[model samples]
Target chain A: MNTWEIRFAMGNEAIAEGALAAGARFYAGYPITPSSEIAEIASRRLPQVGGVFIQMEDEIASIAAIIGASAAGKKSFTATSGPGVSLMQENLGVAVMSEIPCVIIDVQRSGPSTGLATKPAQGDVMQARWGTHGDHGIIALAPSSVQECYDLTIKAFDFSEKYRTPVYLMADEVIGHMREPYVLHEAAGLVSRKQPDPSEPGGDYKIFDFERYDDHIAPMPPYGGKYIFRMNGSMHDEAGFGCGASDNADKFIRHYEDKITKNRDDIVMTESYNMEDADYVLVSFGCSARSAMAAMRLARQEGEKVGVLKLMTLWPFPDKEVAAALKKAKAAVVPEMNLGQVASEVSRYNERKIPVIGVNRVDGSMITPYQILDALKGLYLKGLSLKGL
Target chain B: MKQRWEIIFSGVGGQGLLLSGNLLGAAVSVIEKRQAVMTCTYGTETRGTFTKSDVILSDGYIDFPEVLDADVVVSLAQIAYDRYVDVLKPKTLFLYNSNQVKEAPSPARQVGLPMEEMAAQAGAPAAVNIVALGILTALTKCVQPTSIQEMLTRHFKGRQDVLGANIKAFEAGLEEAGK
Candidate 1:
């Protein structure tokens, strides 16, 4: 295949293209602000490629359809906004317990409920990590730009396949509606799930559980495959037979936790900007990482040794790498669109002693470069120093 | 070792700021064979508030990819022009439509062009974006005009004849900017 050139396309269009490239044959979603375009594009494009697109009655049904389609062997995805994300939480829990591999795209807007439909917000940062209940772990990657919207969506589906779990593509309004040149690489390492061995006798198959929890990600037999087994959200034994015992319940939770927790190194990702020998470090993710990089470059030109740690993966947070960077830096500033959601995590590494400042904006607009630069200047004037972490 | 530029295009929604930035990014990526990234944010207020796009063109992968201080800033609305004028780097160049914006900010060298009138004269009312793209290329010498034409042909092949007037409008913009 020839190397394809990157050109300008809307973020929604990029998502559709990425899904198509990553072998997602079905999409179920409802129309909502900042995310409706994904459904619109998918509806028009999926039919031509022999894929399926369905506009569900609401967000609840949308996620349910996605989960159902994935179980039936088609790679499936759904995109939604603030209110829609809230409505789909229950089905997401069902998907987690059932171990169905799918992708969820949340183009987040400002609000607890329908606050600002078209405005940008990182308020759902924590929500993406802990939206569903119980001891289930999910892979969530936040794309800072339109190109990443394409690249990360593919990665999200791959992670879901590898772990036999659901993944979240958490994008904000700023990155969703933005038009950027998106070059689809022919060599973009695409990952597909493993199919169960057909040669293994049907009676020996276990769909949900096994003797050991470490290999919790068992090969999933797709629909129409020769293997025969049952799958459910309820607690089950090694043979996938329904079991209500407390030990079975404990083992189920352990399987969910072990699959993700053990692969934290492979899941966590961060990009450092001029971090070596830096006096100050700025921790930012999603759209705010764009502004933080801009501010860092300007500060460097003006003779300030400032660096940035841009997080590409939100869940399975890279705590070790972040802590190491914060150790030698004089101060750390976290700038985000929400009222400092990621700053809470940074504070967990070192509290009030590290001169940890937060530059927050809740006005549904991105934090500008001047705001971050001013915060850095204020920290310098106050002579606040970093704590020895 | 290679040419790298960070360009920003800011204006109102209907002014086609995003289109201009996209055109530049496309030209740089497809024609120049460089890795280019463009990102934008338009206000929820529809056509009234300022809309801005940041474009970064580099030979290597752009990791810290944000438009900090632009090497070139283009504006079609007075509000966007005034907002970024003083904040832009002293070396940064400014290009604005003289028909819409009458005043130029201090310090930076400003090149004003009657691009809307030129596009109208070229028989395309909405071709002002392509017109601005041509003028920006001529002023900065960042991408070749021939490469831009090749990119436009590849990008608008489906539309076909719609590009004839737009190409003429771009040439008119180049001529007007020269004066």
Candidate 2:
């Protein structure tokens, strides 16, 4: 018997529902435009499911609260906008260094600093990658549609649990505010944090046991569990005590980076549309991918062989898939709300030396299909000129 | 049936433009089992400012949510009519509230209706947006009137008086378009 239900919902509502479906038990957040709906829904629905919801004084407190909740063995998450995300950066680092499992939903708005409170922008792509001022690896997922907003939020929780790290659901105002139809399905393949074995010896429980675990990820027991261990924000030894040794610092730092980099295959996801035997490629993520898809369809109608490579996983960047697409295409177009954030990444993988164009919009409006098609037409004209020579 | 239909409902804030768009979207997406995307743009203030909702109904996947080429455009305010009149294509069906906007020279096919007057006549002056929606339903036939009626019944479930007035307003709109 199928248990799916179809409903018309906004993207922000989908994210909140997705969290509930993924077994998120606690939510702490401050209201912000484009993302306030998530917090609103969570505040009302979390309690109905016997979960907890708290409206923090600010974004800093919000992140700190969720970190505290997750440390106590709850699947916790928070939602906010770009400015709020900027405020949460310090606490975000604490989650990273302490290796606490949590999810942060950043519904991006136009900004260098609250540039446009209610408008959508993809300016936070680089920020999500290196926002917290650390060399640590991060996992960020972009959702272009309401359905993805639902599906990827659950994936974010699963990744946070499996890897014991904070994951980002990088949404934009377009997806957050826009309403569309989506099906709610029973979540399968849910991952929870590995807990320390209760039957084993209780004393001297090394919280960061790299040597015992081949994957380098140690089981994280709750605060009130049998194993009492420390969670240090500073560089620490395997036993979680503050260690100032140079080599100890190196090992733990490398452990943090290697855990994600070594497991890239399991973490990264990308979608290919009309990419089979295409000469032109469009690389985009977040809301911009929708425009790319529309442009690809229009170009196809005009008999232009254009394809789209949508980045579902933003961080631990899909290097292999991007490099492969860039190598095959005659030319590439990177459309984004920001000016060339993801385009720079696409160009880095441009080993084929083909022309990589950037279609950008920051006027608080979406990058329309016509704008992207214009870029493709320019590339087509350039290709014709080269062929004539 | 048309493979795709892109419609825009534009007016000042508090005119129930977003509600009209939502009703149409829910009708097609949920009742008809088709795909629909509704995106609304408004200012920080809740009322007396320009507001527009773009609804795109498609038989296949909708890549871009905004209207690239509008099949039908409904304007209930002069600012909205002025904003979109020049951008419309010749084949586009442009609907306007004659009570608020003066007839403008345009290439697109134009249909003018007194939505405010129709709503008052329907005994629901606040439901001008529903009257406009009714006219849209009659002209486009994108979704069945019964589908929209089902949505209205669901939307105004508790308020019987409002529901009756809105149903009468919607019928008034459908009747005006038919004539």
DockQ of each: 0.36, 0.83
Instruction: Evaluate model 2: give its lDDT.
Output: 0.91
Poorest 10 consecutive residues by lDDT, candidate 2 chain A: A380-389
In terms of TM-score, the best-performing candidate is: 2
Q: Write the per-residue lDDT of candidate 2 for residues A1-389, one digit (tens) a residue.
A: 14788878899999999999999999999999989999999999999999999999999999999999998999999999999999999999989888899999999999989788878999999998888886889999999999999999999999999998999999999999999999888799799789877687876788788668877788998876677778888888888899999998888777778888888999999999888977889999988999999888888887788899999999889989999998778889999999899989888888978999999999889999999988877875775422211
Give me the iRMSD of candidate 2, please. Answer: 0.7
Q: How far out, in Å, is residue A169 in model 1?
A: 1.7
lDDT of 1 by residue, A1-389 (tens): 23775666767778877887788989999999899889998999889889999999999999999988998888999999989999999889988888889999999899989998878888998887788888888888998877888888888888988898899999888788766567776536776676665567764567774443445577777754566656666777766678899988998888787778888898888889899978999999888998898788778888788899989998877777788879888889999988878888887776335778899998987888889988988886786642221
Cα deviation at B161, candidate 1, in Å, is 1.9
Error of 2 at B77 (Å): 1.5
Candidate 1's residue-wise lDDT over B1-179, tens digit each?
32888888877888777777777777777677777777776766768688878888887666444576578888877888888767766788887877778775556667777778888998887877778888878777777788778766776788867778777877877776666
Model 1 chain A poorest ten-residue lDDT run: A380-389
